[model samples]
Target: MTAGMPAEKSMNFGPSARRLLARLSPQRGQVLAVAALAVLSVACTVIGPKILGRATDVIFTGLLGKQFPAGMTHDQAVAAVRASGNANVADMLARMDVVPGRGIDFTALRNVLLVVLALYVVASLLMWLQGYLLNGVVQATILRLRADVEDKLNRLPLPYFDGQPRGELLSRVTNDIDNISQTLSQTLSQLLTSLLSVIGVLTMMFVISPLLAVVALVAIPLSVLVTRLIAKRSQRQFVAQWTHTGALNGQIEEAYTGHELVKVFGRQQEVQAAFAAKNEELFRASFGAQFVSGIIMPSMMFIGNLSYVAIAVVGGLRVASGAMSLGDVQAFIQYSRQFTQPLTQVASMANLLQSGVASAERVFAVLDAAEQSPEPARPARVTDRHGRVEFEHVSFRYQPDKPLIEDLSLVADPGHTVAIVGPTGAGKTTLVNLVMRFYELDAGRITLDGVDITTMRRDELRGEIGMVLQDTWLFGGTIRDNIAYGNPNATEEQILAAARATFVDRFVRSLPDGYDTVIDEEGSNVSAGERQLITIARAFLADPSLLILDEATSSVDTRTEVLLQRAMAALREDRTSFVIAHRLSTIRDADLILVMEQGRIVEQGTHQELLAAGGAYARLYHAQFSAAAVDLDEAAAAGAGQVPAGVGPRAGGPRPRIPAS
Candidate 1:
């Protein structure tokens, strides 16, 4: 947990692969189609070689038929057979043979070449079809993989997001999955092609000569062993490669988000060094995986050539004698090459397998993470009615051994406002977070409208509570859209009315676009004060039965504070409002004010009543008085607006007016 970083605890491959397969379920038919094509291509490959071998055998016997002796040189045997035939048997024979065809027998030679041409054409077409279909499944599935990952991210728990880096997650969701998808597209077809070729070669070899067939397989086990070892090592390196890539992404994201701070601190060099280190780390790891896996293909090819040479040396003598025909030797050499082709292919694609699995693993991790538990087995609906809230013996903490809130309980009726005052880290936000169901309580319960808040659907409960934060969070959208987000179905007049309630209409009506202006990401286009007002108006538009205003004025200027005070008063009328404010002046008229310390309520009362009691509330009130006076004095020196501490024209006055028909 750096100053700002999210952990990669949810990274895994098992769940992701399963999810991928499920999504690719629709494309299984394509896979089967490709498989059928692979089988057909293999058939062509085997049959083509067999036909050439038969042609060789027929030509050899034609040249050596009924030789003068049982053993003779190829030329002597042709002389003897030609003596009997009354013509050059070599011419008749070579013409029938594909390899030599010394004197072309136009008909026989043409047939062999034509058959070879047909096999090549058929095999190429099948391979092309297989590649096209497989690639289609791979890329399409990956796009869906990214979409699903994004959806899961949207649903993940808030705590899951806290303290995590944005860049690392982006890497997993984008780069890693993309690498996997690419590997699948490039390797799957080649893998099947290589495999089918091997099978076809082996079967044809058996048909040609069983003894030579066994010799060709001598290197198969050795190749598989080497491949397995290299593949396992590659998997680890691929995982490391992806992890480093994510770390680099996290660093870059953080640097950009805090670009101003980095610039001010003159830490550009430092940032560069950090990024370069991670970048190099990824490079080294990926290089290791790729370099090792790359060795497998060439090594298998070398072994394949060696096996072919050995088969030729051994099978050649048999043909020289009366034991074999020239055709058997030719077929055996072809069969020997087949042994390593598939091995070579799988070895070639080992990198893709590793990277793909690594990325899918990371994706699966997020998909596998436990989501925020659903609201309940059966949820009670919340209607817009009385806003009665109670916290009964609620004890909660974000972490064990550090209680943020302990045995805390309280209640407020509808049409009432509750002000909760506490020092920083007194669990003010935690309390409201519980109410928001952002975190579950360790003990006790909270109720709304005479029913446990937990009994209501999470979305439905949130729909009935409006929150206005100190640092107002605004999405990039039009002014009207931001205000209308709370009630997307809201009419234009309803949005304007909501804006008016929070005095947001004043600024918005002045804009040239009125309601169509586009805001930057985080509403950076608007002033901080105006952003707060917009959020307040958004909450007002929601018209929830309960309102939660957390740190509503902590980070704003004095003039902005004044605006917030007005918005708070107007918005709190006729609603159940919980205002967590350190600025005592803002919540002075609360129907109930609870002064809290160390997660426990030390004092509870009306404003004047607590000031008269001269306890926690009195101390807080006086402390803020001096602070407000100091702030006002500072503002006076700087020519700025200020909020008067205790009493203004409306000090100790009745509640502000609520909108009525």
Candidate 2:
């Protein structure tokens, strides 16, 4: 199964194709206009061949009539032929309205030629107009479809993104949509024109000669059979081609995004091999699809040629027996070619149609995904806007069978700093995520200042909170622009103040462009520590009543971290803050400390109290400090002389002194 795909795939071609066509419902008026114009244009085109046949007849009759005696009347000429024992020839000549005693009449022939030319000219104009209108209809339909897909994306929950590959999702939104546009643009008007031409030509063929028409009709079943056989096989290949396309895109995106890591680990060959495998899969699928569908046009043309040959033989015999006129026979031959031409065109378009519907199915998959539950229609508001948060017997699980957090309860009063510490996979981050309502609870509820969080709109609840995560994200823009993202309407003074408070202004001032420095798409222009600082500055600018810092200062050096800690101390003065950190020293001054293990709080108290209690928090703190003490002693023994006990590492060393908490 493709990443993030629904359990049931919409692989049926008929339903998917019909759904694609349904998108054009909004442009019904334009579609109807295009259809009407196609009918008129085909009517004119079908009439042109018949009128041109008259011109051929006029020239032929005049040439034959002039060969007879100069003064012979029309009846005398026919009687002369019959007297000569050529009764069939006499009957054929009787059907022609020819003046036997005269040479070719150029005036009547000119009139017939003029009418044929006029019919073709009108046909061309109508075709051009229909194409213009259909372009609008196709573009409008695609525009609306794109909008719906974008809207659907915003409504999807975070877990949907967690399971989906970024590159695969991008392919559906961009590449798939582009393919659909091209298919509709190239196929819509042409399909309509081809179908109408087939109908108009078939009508004219039967009118001219039904026996010959029946001979021409023999190819229809053969054509249909060949098309069905080829299309059935090629459709599967087309689906595989698109699926491989998305997989290849996903691999390429992951490789490029982690190019530095790949180089660091010396895994370039492995990455290349994976890429080659995916590329080969895509190539094979594409070749199979094209080669199979490619056979259809020639197959159709061959069948039509057989019918053409049979029609020519039968029409000739009928003309000789005087059952059909020379002019009508000429028209019937033209009609046969016209009838077969449209079938060939449709056959040639099979590959595009198949590929287009495949892309449509992928796009519809995104649209049909289950969305996040809707927000409350009449949402409750936090009137006083205090930062107090409470979790009342909250229970949740990522999977239905595996319970992660069960009946957990906690509370942080307004203007208090609550610090959480735990080993990996202990639900530390999950607790903070619950406060943000990133996922809904399986049972019980969470509230902010006594209002149920679910009852409040997500945007409104998130607006009053600021977060700085462990992984910093920065877009391509000036540093000033990135900082301003946290508060779009913030003044220049406010932005600069936040930067100074977070110690970002210190290093930024030493750079060439300072605040105006442009970051690359990956933010490679700056160090990781600087990137983290920028995110911190952004959160500071937001200045929310609630703040959550998840290892926010992990990337910075000791001196910079010390400066940031002082700034954070002032920032946390009157706001409720939830700080999750592995570095115990950073949270020693927090108002309350909660040590968690396996999704439950094993201990909670002030730092000194927890250490004296000799519980999980004490073990964690002693373990961290003992490791630091051992490292310092090892460095001293390796260097000059064994240093005295309880001393620090060499000055300006990589490791910082372990302060007493």
Candidate 3:
């Protein structure tokens, strides 16, 4: 139904199918070659039984020549055969022993057997070639499909990823792609060969005896009906199974990613219970779909066997009635088996085909999703070094009706630090998102150096700005690599200098591998403060004209914070910077302090000026010290053995309290 969602109803095996086929257009020549080989393979196999039947007739005629019938002379038997008017039997009799029961025609039998053997060998070789070529074609098509999906992922907007589960999206790119590969590599060729066999066998059967052909074909409708009914019921279960599996994958990803938090909160049992519930749902749906689809093979086999028995019975009757030769009747039975065989095979594969198509539909849905609007045909480049930014009456909302930032306006002049402080939901991070153009505004514009950012190429616009987010992100790499991430081409000297500037060098030299040590994902092996330092170092290496530090010093200790402040002061001396921090003391000396509330700036001024005004910023600044004072009083009261009226024993001078048994 949507990107990152499991396929719902079975895809229309129509235009979407054609579109998938169109993807294979580049390999059309190879496809045609495989088809030609399949045709030859089917032809040889279909002709083999007919030739074998002739050999059987040859043996029968040899036996009959030795012993005609009870009292029948050779002449009478020949007359009877002539009246039957079968060319193959006549031809076989001509080569057999002339005298009655003289001897067997071993030489002729050997010749016929050789031809049959050669036919089979060639057919087998052709089949092998068909598979070999088809594999190449299928893989090439898959390669293109995978590339297209990867390109689509890069082109999609951030909101697309924000709404979809990473695990579900991964399933489409990996699991779904693999499904389509399996189907094309194996099922597609098999389906073609089976259909050809069915057509060729039917033609041969009719030529042998129209009545027997009719009897053999009775299973077609019956098998189709059974398979169709079961497939209809099973399709929904298949969809449900895939959907639950995706959900389960998402749950596993979240649980594992937040495993530390789960342990801290003692939620192991809760997480296990949730996983078990999702797993059970997946199992139920998978079992139902598999079990129901599994019924097709046996049901088709039963119907096929019924048809086989009828053809044998009726064909034997015709042979006895002199309406057909022994060879024709024998070939007819073989053809009857061949006809029902593909029917049974196709019936059994009904669910597999359905599933493959569903996977293709899911893959196609992602490819077809609306991509981010293209860059302007003639894009402007932001090359100004002034770092002047202005948000001009910009309005934005995650949802349309509930506006987060309505007609918001702000300006950051060159060579100044703008420290933004606000409550959690007061649109603080949104400002960074807007500046980077991660999302487009609903109305109005944002400008850099008085040039509208929307007109500039995204890469050119972002090149002038650098960010060190509150969440320090260091991918799996050596410390040197992480520090040089913002400037991949940075020299060893530059990297070391940035590290020293951020006070990161203090810890780097103490590590076992120094700058060469590899960190685990998310820098989990390092302390939070160390990771923050590395990110700060990375940003410093970039040395952009505009810097955004969103709570960059939040995780560091006071000593590290003081060092960072010194480094930042020097870095921000002649560069425009935006700093969002909760600790008022961190941004007390900023050139400008903007206090926000509910997406609106309630106060904007220097720290001293705001404190003098005694507005929102002043109250917030005083509140922090007041809360600290309250904590100190409680601690002092406990040390004095003076229990406050509502205080517990532990808060009353560390008194001995009864431990819970």
Return the TM-score for each candidate structure: 0.82, 0.93, 0.91
User: Arrange candidates by lDDT, highest first: which order?
Assistant: 2, 3, 1
Predictions: Cα RMSD each:
9.1, 5.0, 4.5
lDDT of 2 by residue, 1-661 (tens): 3662221332588999999999999999999999999999999999988888888888879988887988788899999999999999888888888787677779989999899889889999999999999999999988999999999998998888888888889999999999999999999888989999999998898888778888998999999999999998898888888888888899999999999999999999999999999899889989999999999999999999999999889988887787888888889888989999999999999999999999999999899999988999999988887788898998889899988888888889988899999999898998888888888889989888889999999998888889999999998999999999999999999999999999899989999999999997678989999999999999999988799999998998889999998898888766789999999998998899999998888899999999999999999999998996777556656454554554455664544433333
Runs in model 1 deviating more than 4 A are: 2-23, 52-102, 322-328, 509-512, 617-661
Q: Global CA lDDT of candidate 1, please?
A: 0.76
The per-candidate count of clashes, in order, stands at 9, 0, 2
Q: Considering lDDT, which of the candidate structures 1 and 3 is the better prediction for this target? A: 3
When 1 and 2 are scored with lDDT, the better candidate is 2
lDDT for every model? 0.76, 0.89, 0.83
**Top model number, TM-score:** 2
Cα deviation of 387, candidate 3, in Å? 1.6
What does candidate 3's lDDT look like per residue over 1-661, in tens digits?
Answer: 1432345565475666677778888988999999999999999999998999888877877777775555565666666666788655544444443456444578888998999999999999999999999999999999999999999998898888888887777877888789888877768788899999999999888877888888887788888899989988887777666667667778888899889999999999999999999888888988988899999999988898899889878877666655777888888888877887888788877777766766687788789988887888888776657888888888889998787888888899988999999888999889878888889889989988888888888888888788988888888889999999989999999999999999899999999999999998778889999999999999999988789999989999998898888888888765789999999999988999998888888899999999999999988888887896775676667557775566665443544342322
What is the TM-score ranking, best to worst? Answer: 2, 3, 1
Candidate with maximal lDDT: 2
